[model samples]
Target: MDSDSRLDLEFAYTTYRDCCRDLYSPYYYCRRPLGHDGVHAAGFGSGRVRWEHRPDHAPHLLS
Candidate 1:
């Protein structure tokens, strides 16, 4: 892939990773970045996270 495409892919991947790390669990579906700003906020469910979801990004429970 070209540099631009590669960057886009990397950015997308990073966004997805950050989404799972900052917004929800790895099992949750995370949308693409909402803005061009670096480290843009990620969205998961309910349009926004609830109080209980503040720690949604926390590590999953070991089973």
Candidate 2:
């Protein structure tokens, strides 16, 4: 892949890792980020993460 595409993939993976760490944290219940609906909404309530690749850009996760 090109440099731009590699960068985009790295960024996406970093974001995904950070998100997973935060979502799975035990302290998330008491120290949740702003706008995070409670634990259930942030975790169990959501569907599986889906990654989509666009023809003109890098792949991204669909929330």
Identify the leading candidate in terms of lDDT: 1
In model 1, the worst 10-residue window by lDDT is 44-53
Question: Relative to the true structure, how large is the alpha-carbon lDDT of every model?
Answer: 0.38, 0.32
**Whole-structure CA lDDT of model 1:** 0.38
Write the residue-wise lDDT of candidate 2 on 1-63 in tens digits: 963454344344444324423332333311222333323113212332222223575323233
Candidate 2 is scored at a TM of 0.24
Give per-model TM-scores.
0.24, 0.24
Q: Which portions of model 1 miss their true places by more than 4 Å?
A: 16-63
Determine the C-alpha RMSD for candidate 1 after optimal superposition of all C-alphas: 9.4
lDDT of 2: 0.32
lDDT of 2 at 19: 44
